[model samples]
Target: MSKSDQLINISVIMSVLIFVSAWIVGLATHKLPVLTTVLNLVVGLSIFIYWLQKQIRINQHIIEGREIVVLGCELIVIACAVYSIVFKQWNGWVKGFQYIFFGIHLSALVLFLIFMLTFKMNKLM
Candidate 1:
């Protein structure tokens, strides 16, 4: 890989590690939960944007169909997270919606991981 690509990968990995560690520490200490949540949301949104831009640039076309739908769901989950953080006192309905979006986010994450792994394996073979 090129130097710049290597650098970007390293930086992304390091930041993820730092965030994960901070999240774990926050949970263990029962402190900084809000801060960690905010950080996680911001990072997740940033990564999504970065990946979208990279895909567009590399493919020279807009992402469509299933990718677009998944991206929309990801955005919804981020919005729900922000809403929860901002309101901090959700009613039953709001909480239910948040839970639904959270499930969508988890499913999207797993689906993307599987796609990536399969693509890599296909490339290797």
Candidate 2:
């Protein structure tokens, strides 16, 4: 990967780790509302914006149906996060969003690792 891509990847990983850690800590202690809510929203929004930019750059053409769906998902997550922050409570809607966010991200990470492993194995063969 180029330096910029590496940097982006590192940042994404760090932010995700921080996000997870914050959630765990908040759940355990019920303290650090700023870290749990505000930081999470900021990091989540930044990640979504990064992905949106990359998607646009790659496609170059207008966003198609799939991109629109992705955008909607991002917006849903953002909206849920905002609602949770404002309400200061985790309702079913917020919990559902949290589950979906982690599920999507974790599955994508697993698929990426699988693809990279297969590519490397093919190169060795």
Candidate 3:
């Protein structure tokens, strides 16, 4: 696999791990302030966008369908995050699932920083 592929894999793993962590945090915390809600929504959305960008083989492989399903899962997570953020509370498991999104965004932030250091940038025309 190429560096780009490795980066994507690492990012995906990070996303999943952070997502788990977030859920843990959410269940452990009871208060949902406005800032927390907005933060969660933003983080979830960011992860979904990143994964959607790298999931580039829907029509080319047998596993594409599974990947697509995962994509939908991510989107649902994002939706839940946004929902919690806006409403200040979720009625069910959505609450627990929203925190990990901030963790995913945190992981992505780290990877992006490493990428900036690893790759050189030039002016693109």
TM-scores of all predicted structures: 0.54, 0.58, 0.44
* Cα lDDT, all candidates: 0.58, 0.62, 0.59
- Residue pairs clashing, model 2: none
What's the CA error at residue 22 for candidate 3, in Å? 14
lDDT of 1 by residue, 24-90 (tens): 7755876444544455466559768887777777846656798777667667657766876888835
Give each prediction's root-mean-square deviation over alpha carbons: 5.7, 5.3, 8.5
Ranking by TM-score: 2, 1, 3
Residues 56-118, model 3: lDDT tens digits: 735553446876775676677667766765676755666546545555556666676566557
Residues 1-125, candidate 2, lDDT per residue (tens digit)? Answer: 45554554565566556656766886688654545446546646876888767777784666679867876776776777788877876656566566567556655655654554344332221
The Cα RMSD in angstroms, rounded to one decimal, for candidate 1 relative to the true structure is 5.7
The reply for model 2, stretches above 4 Å from the true place, is: 31-40, 47-61, 106-125
Model 1 pairs in collision:
none
**Could you tell me which 10 consecutive residues in candidate 2 have the lowest summed lDDT?**
116-125
Candidate 1 residue 106 C-alpha distance from true site, Å: 11
